[model samples]
Target chain A: MDFVQLKKNCKKDASAFPGYRLALLGDCATQHLAMALKGAAYEEGIALSVFDADYNQLDAQTLDPSSELYEGKPQGVVLCLCTEKLYEAFTLSSDRAGFADATFRKIKGYWDRINAHLSVSILQFTFVERDDRVFGNYALKEETSFYYQVKKLNLLIAEGTRLVKNVYPVDVDSLERRLGRDKFSDPKLYAIAKMPFSLEALPLVAFETVGIVKALMGRFKKCVVLDLDNTLWGGVIGDDGMEGIQIGELGTGHAFTELQRWLKELKNRGIILCVCSKNNENTAKEPFEKHPEMILRLDDISLFVANWHDKASNIRYIQKTINIGMDSIVFLDDNPFERNLVKQTVEGITVPDLPEDPADYLPYLQSLNLFETTSYSENDRDRTKQYQAEIGRILLEQSFESFDDYLKGLDMVAEAKSFDPFHYPRIAQLTQRSNQFNLRTVRYTEAEIEKIAGDERYLTLYFTLKDKFGDHGLISVVILEKRERELFVHEWLMSCRVLKRGMEEFIVNKMIETAKEYGYASVVGEYIKTPKNAMVETIYAKLGFTDRGDHTFVADCATFQPNKTFIKE
Target chain B: MERNEILEKLNEIFRDVFDDDSITVTEETTSSDIEDWDSLTHITLISEVEDEFDIKFAMKEVVGMKNVGEMVDIIEREA
Candidate 1:
């Protein structure tokens, strides 16, 4: 879809709740990135409104600190950082089409300022290798410098992002990968064309970058479900038997083992791994428990169900157990029948096309990028062990049949911490991906979240859950913006794994207490209807908040009753 | 290849770029003669012609490619 069609679709699709308002800022040089962003927004279910400005008509003053451009509310704003504009901004005289360095600085400065207000801002780094082979006949070394300048601009964008929270660098290198090196050598062709790529590249870049923006701002899937047999290994475990199955060194067997190692790595990246296999429970358990070659032990699986059940039904069982939306679950199967069946049966579960070759499995699964993240920290590496601990927690809960009994047996300990510098990245990620239990569902980029927290007008809260099992890491976030005496709950979402565990009670209770401490009259909640968030339609009502129109829920802080059972820290 | 043969090869590049099978070629045929000869396609067509003929034209020569005649003359000189 083009930018216009994608925007229209995103506005109409009920799944992309908390729609985005976008501003496309650039001259001719940046138009393709704008187009690419539009395509990406459509794919991501984000409502985008684009305003393309004429390069020659832009006024430096408007993009300055005191201008209204920064004042306009947009979910995300994209800027083109090409050398053509940079050269013009540096050298062109005002009458003929030149601006002072101050103007360019102001442009960059204003974007930083806007990022301080917006939820997400994507900056397209300057692309080298434009079709300039003949236009300005520079030597080979000069062309190398031109390419070096793009890298330098990318660094500038990266450093500039530190000043604004949700500022993200779109990899121009990856964007240019579509354009082969030969396209740059022909002077007859390259001289007249300023843009490097074909018309096809524009929509694609816009679409993919917008996806990056949404991923930075919106919610991602919470759980990754695996099918055994050919998916996790080279051949069917039931057919090959434990001894014959591929899980060791050399050939196709090593491929399956490598895929398992990758999945284990993914688990470390916080994608919960659940096994839905059709095998004799005893038969499947043999490799997991006894085989030394097994890369994924029983402890590796967050939820394991081995039976003859339909794969989709088994996935639903796990989803219900976790209390997460089907949209947040990614199912992988080597069998096309099982994959097609789940795709037909489950409306929202993402089942990527399975590869036939065992060697292709690792790349195919990795390419799905179920746990794609922009920023990586040391703590993310330990996500698997935490989920294993959660599985242990689930097993511990089975000791009691009743809900209250389960709560009592763990001697539940909940720690509530306000947002700090350390938890910023995790909090930003949770806000982007947590769906079913999200109230309001306002997505935030890292820069936007930082700005929101820095501003006195907004209060952001992050909750780290650790029951008797262990720490669930930073799994939940609540964003509130001040409106006179009221704190408007702009964004509230919790990782679905922590759902039904009374962790929501712990967080909401904290919000109520916080409202009282801050002297706010009422703590308002919102339940914006989204295709994936139907589960949270009654979350506010269950928490004793009065429903208002347009999915807003309200409750007075004075009369709020805290669920006394959740042990607070 | 002589000038006539080079022009014939160049004509093929033009036909492919414009996606027109029945396009007539002369020294005076400009991009305006056929559709799909926008800026991007112009680059593609010229690049293909240069590769086929093993000769590169200057940027001024490509930009000055108003008619088929100018394109043929540039190719003739370069080749």
Candidate 2:
């Protein structure tokens, strides 16, 4: 969207939508940027209430205890320290050699103080690279030059913030490089109004900022639903056969190769890759199985759905089998008719407008930033194998006569243990990403998880499951707070991939066992209703806990019978 | 473009930017005549006019344009 359209969106009434409070702290004037942020958020069904700080008050607002920044109680704080202001500081500094480190120290102090007051996510804008070019080409070798310092400062911001779990660098430096410095900044506008970015660049910056907010709020794409023919490679796989279809590093085939390489990287990073195609099942499997030049093999895909039905129905089936929200899936198809059909049918799925030329596919997709994740762990690399095992279990279930028989035949094993420092990252990620099976959904960062692991008042458990097929790594998390006479289930969530496999029964039995061992008379569980968590609304009642009629369920530890499950703990 | 033609186009831009259909601009019309026009909207108005005319307004013209007639003069000269 352009500046005018985004500005007009600011006037629309967004009172009914979900609201996100954000405090915008910038050294430059931020009225226009605030408007653009709200406008961009409105387009995504988020009513962003921005607390725009006063002009050049970054120090005053962040340092003071009773400042408006604290009073606003924002869920997020955005810090924009522009390159123009940084250049002025560089020019006035007495010691240019230590400029980057000193500036980074001051910025880190702001993050530390704000985090001490409130546990809110800090979205910091990296310094955009700008040079006066006084030393020309020799500036690259000069550590004291403004250009060199700015580059080093950007790197320092990235590396320094890695130690803090709540601080997220917005990478505005990359945005400037992509848009070109001239297009991103206009000196005349900066001189007139103290605004750093041009009107045209404001919307892009606003979108990028809101993207991080969306991910932090537990809204992000988790899977990529792909089309095989023409979309993944050149020509139809059915007509061209496995050998004739283009993929590798020759001619237009190189374009598809690059796209597949990127998709492979995404799969390795925990984004589930699924296939929904309109070709024959065998024909679609042939290319992935037999083609020598194919970058994506049959093992890379989690759920492969190749049928003769319309793509919209096929995609819905894929969504149902994977047990993720339709909004978390991105559908890519080369045909406009298929794209429009799926776009109109699916309510929340993202279907990008694939360009006509095959070569423009990867570049266009990269610019959209379809995948934005807040947390990652080493366990993410094993996600594809877990899903593939799930598919294997599903196929095995079809041959069984009864559901109980299928569960017992799988030979499932589970391990439950208290929270360790090693599993904290994966536990926190499950809290942020799992929405369907979550009860009283409370998102915690890695730091909060670490605190909970050390605190005596809270009891934490992380569960892992494996069957005869493969291992589902660190699938569930339960955090219980000890009360006067009972244990309160503060947070309980599980990965949807492990649903309907007697995992909930296994977890509840473990919870009561722990409470009995601790000498608590009763265990209480609460179910908070959300739009996506209705699947688990009556879960406690179904698990034999007496409903207390006020969203709380009670189980007497003395009389509680251990739930019968197929899994051995 | 004729002077009257420029005025007619400016009237459309003014109505669109201010979200009003009845706004009619002439040589005497300025920021004071419009209820929503301020320093913030003034920059937006300048940007809209530049985009519509496919011309770049000088920094002076952006901040110092006295009336709708002055805006039209720049558009006429640049167009």
Per-residue alpha-carbon lDDT of candidate 1 for residues A74-178, written as tens digits (9 for 90 to 100): 555566544455544433444212232244355576565565555556554444434334325542345233333344445555666665556666665555655
Query: Candidates' TM-scores?
Result: 0.59, 0.80
- Which candidate ranks first by DockQ, i.e. highest? 2
lDDT of 2: 0.91
Report how far residue A324 has shifted in candidate 2, in Å.
0.7
Could you give the fnat of all candidates in order? 0.38, 0.23
Taken over the whole model, the C-alpha lDDT of each candidate is 0.67, 0.91
Q: Which residues of candidate 2, in runs, are more than 4 Å off?
A: A249-251, A408-465, A472-569
Interface C-alpha RMSD per candidate, 1 decimal: 8.1, 1.4
RMSD to the hidden true structure, all candidates: 11.6, 7.7
TM-score of 1: 0.59
Clash totals for all candidate models: 22, 0
For candidate 1, the per-residue lDDT at A452 reads 78
